[model samples]
Target: MSDTTTVGPDTAGIGRTRTPTPFRRLLAVETRKLFDTRSGKIMTAVMVVLTVGAIAGRGLYAGPRLEVLIGTAGLSLGTLLPVLGILTVTGEWSHRTALTTFTLEPRRGRVLAAKCLPPLIAAVAASAFAILVAVPVTAAVSAVRHVPADWDLTPVALLGWTAANVLVVAMGLALGMLLLNAPAAIVICLSAPALWSAVARIGSVGETLAGWLDLNTTAGPLMEGHMTGGDVARLAASVSFWIVVPLATGTARVIRKEIG
Candidate 1:
């Protein structure tokens, strides 16, 4: 005798056409997951608190120029966004839920894309929040310091601040996809710049490499609202190395890695 099981009439594909889960739905789920975990909640709270602190510190330190306020908020976010990005991808793997996730959505590429998009969205949102918060903070600072505030924000400034946040977070996502271990991904994402800086101190060759490939140096001009063609070229080169390469490799790994 052969063992057999009966499928439900509605679920057996006999009476209905099954639609693939929508990508938008996947995005929604992924976005919700960002705030659903305890760690995620804690990280978010920390980010909020840090941004306020950074904005206040900058206002008090140098007066509340719009550009400086946005930059300070972005720098504060950059410090923690990597961890959030890392967990976005690695959380499932680290928590042993990859099997379930892959089972539901067999297309690994979509899953990876979904994981990547939310961090980018968060980066954009963070930048917007920074800008909004800067306005009130600027007014408050002017009152406290009795100096007029500079509200000389430009489109380039907005793009630059957002881009910087996106860069750090994207790097984190890439590392998480490559490593699939939250701790490992977070460590590398945070420490690689320092490691690179150490290497850059070795000699003139290192300096040249840093000028071209160091993300901080290349992205600095864009953030400061004065990027030239050479700066653009260097930024592209550095982004290709730092963000694109690992992201490609990591997607491959995610697709190939067996979920156990």
Candidate 2:
């Protein structure tokens, strides 16, 4: 004899319980986490340091030339900004705080999105901050260098750089989610480009591998506004790799693995 019973939608097994979508939940948590930490404070401090340094360095060293000062200032701080991007997403996993995050959210995808959004937002904010600080610095430098106040804040350049920063941050987030190991992900994100560049410089398999490796030669044109046909193809392939593969791999892990 078989007993058959049908349960209402609300009475379904725990597995069938409707959950908050991962996107909104993750975004809130990620943003909250950024503001609650010493790292966030450190990032703020770095920005201030760059602002002051740009003003002083251009004024004292570069004869206060606006373009020279702005370009030099940007070169100094640009690399660290990307590092900040990497840390934002990787910090949770590195600190093992993701356990708490996952337990609360239960939806892995939402948590991942939340983790990503803050850093991406921060990158845009950084770009604007750079422009703001540069404005005053450019004036100071122009005064020092006796140059005309012909400072150019190319809108296209600003927007392009900001977008590039956001994309790189997103790439870091994707890598973090995929690796689930903070140090490893950070190393890969940082080193991958360097390694590819070095290999590409050599005239061997490295050159071939360079073209195949995404995020180095591939992403350069996308950011720099000089993408050729080969560059565009490589960049597309690289973007696809980061956007698709890491997400797929990470989502599977989040769904199947124990949260804590």
- TM-score per prediction, in order, is 0.91, 0.76
**Per-residue accuracy of model 1 over 61-146 as CA lDDT, tens digit each:** 98969888888887778878888999999988878999999989999999889888988888888778878888899999999989
Please give me the total number of clashing residue pairs in predicted model 1: 0
Candidate 1 collision pairs:
none
What are the runs in model 1 whose C-alpha is more than 4 Å off? 1-17
Cα lDDT of model 2 by residue, 34-106, tens digit: 7678877777687768766766766676564444555554553455555565677667667877687777777
Worst 10 residues of 1 by lDDT: 8-17
Lowest summed-lDDT stretch of 10 residues in model 2? 64-73
* Candidate with best TM-score: 1
Residue 128's C-alpha lDDT in candidate 1? Answer: 85
RMSD of each: 4.2, 5.9
Residue 40, model 1: Cα distance from true site in angstroms: 1.0
Best by lDDT: 1
